[model samples]
Target: MGESAKTEETAALSVRALDDETWPAFARLVEANNGVWGGCWCVGFHVKLGKGRTAAENRAEKEQRVHEGRTHAALVFSDDECLGWCQFGSPEELPEVKSRRLYEKGLVTLPDWRITCFFTGKGLRGRGVANAALGGALAKIARLGGGTVEGYPEETDDRKVSGSFLHTGPMVAFENHGFTRTRPISPHRWVVTRTVAPA
Candidate 1:
């Protein structure tokens, strides 16, 4: 590939905030995952899971939220194709934590935003898409005037876990971006945070 082509390829790894105009790309990424979280359409964090809710219903609810501009995410794009996304919002927006008890153990500070979940396209693993999505989310948060951002990421310590289970993303993803652990929210998941400054 020529230098310009290589540059373009590198440029393709970019981040954009989720909005109505960009919803299509986000939907495409989720659809590729068999509707992510069992056709959740990325609403798993926004609302509590019921005993028996249809995937279509969940999808509709999610769409409605997005349509009303009540959704948020940071999309990672490779050229024109969205390859991954990291969901984020205020603490009230994503109030539930996987391990509620542990999360409450060390609540020294209240957060302005929470990094909840992530999804990377199939066959695009190990391409740094998750990291890009995280960077994008942080950039967006900073643009939102900068504040405390929280995340619950699973730590890897010689034990292997599937990326699918790491919906909140890996520990290193937050660490590399200046996040510090506040407490262990689960056996492998920890509550992490970072304070960003607007660019």
Candidate 2:
């Protein structure tokens, strides 16, 4: 999406696309969190990590992808600081995913957009940053020619889950955004889908 496109905003925050202009803010938030999940830089779904691949390499590669416009996310900002982000892209752009074996076993067709991961600032947990980021992602997808969108979120009604393990977000969050539970991909995780009309 272009910079001129309309941004998704809330009373306390605004959402912007993760691009050249927003890269630094994104980096700052990630850096503050020790590169986010052991230096993942939120690039886990974009590329295969491990086997001596350093966090530094992931950071550099993520930056490179951002520069090349190969990455997509809805970055939430509270004033000038980035609070967090929700990563979204085509299946090809984000090939790696959670519960891959089960996910593929039930996969019928690829979605036009896939909502993979989310990250919120350390102190900003329990706030609506992730929800805002999700709204922002849907808005961005709408502007980018909307279609079928999918997300794998865990059900949290029956038990308590650590926030760190909720990178895909909660079932209530996606449901709040009008996504329907398409099918269960795991014991707790479900594949949710929604259709966003183009803006």
Candidate 3:
């Protein structure tokens, strides 16, 4: 992609805190982007409900939690059109994620925020859309005084697998942004972090 295309795409994609008015389209984007997590609705880390839960139920539960807790996640939009999402917040804010063994090690003591899931639209894939979204998130968090940003990016040798599962983003992308692996939870899953020291 051309630098202009990247710039144009990045400009079109605005990252902002989640709100009531934007949740519907955000949900629709996730549902429509089948390869990006198969209609997850970004509820994988929010709901206590199992994978067996219906999409509608999962969606409602996630909406309820986000509304009730005031837990904010980063949202990517092109003008009024929603394109992608990245869930980030204090560990306490995402109880389901915080309570899981996958996140237990080295998590209890750190006061940090988590970047749990990401979803980008089919048309917007491989366009540096996620990097821009991440830049937006980092800027927002830094402006708010700074905090640690962490994510579990899957490791893969094949670039084809990288495109198919872009939600976790590529480890190289995170590394390019200065994130380093803190620990490896599994062969595919690794915990990476970057601390934004207070200004």
Report the number of the highest-TM-score candidate: 2
Per-residue alpha-carbon lDDT of model 3 for 138-186, expressed as tens digits?
A: 7766776778878778778664575545466678767887899988776
Q: Which is better, 1 or 2, measured by TM-score? A: 2
Residue pairs with backbone overlap in model 3: none
lDDT of 1: 0.84
Candidate 1's clash total is: 0
Best by lDDT: 2
> Which scores better on lDDT, 2 or 3?
2
Our model 2 lands, by Cα RMSD against the true structure, at 5.6
Model 2 residue 14 lDDT?
Answer: 89
lDDT of 1 at 108: 79
lDDT at 63, model 3 = 80
Task: For residues 37-110, write the lDDT of model 1, one tens digit per residue.
Answer: 77878888888878698778887887788788787898888877899889999877777667877677778777
Candidate 2's error at 143, in angstroms?
Answer: 0.3
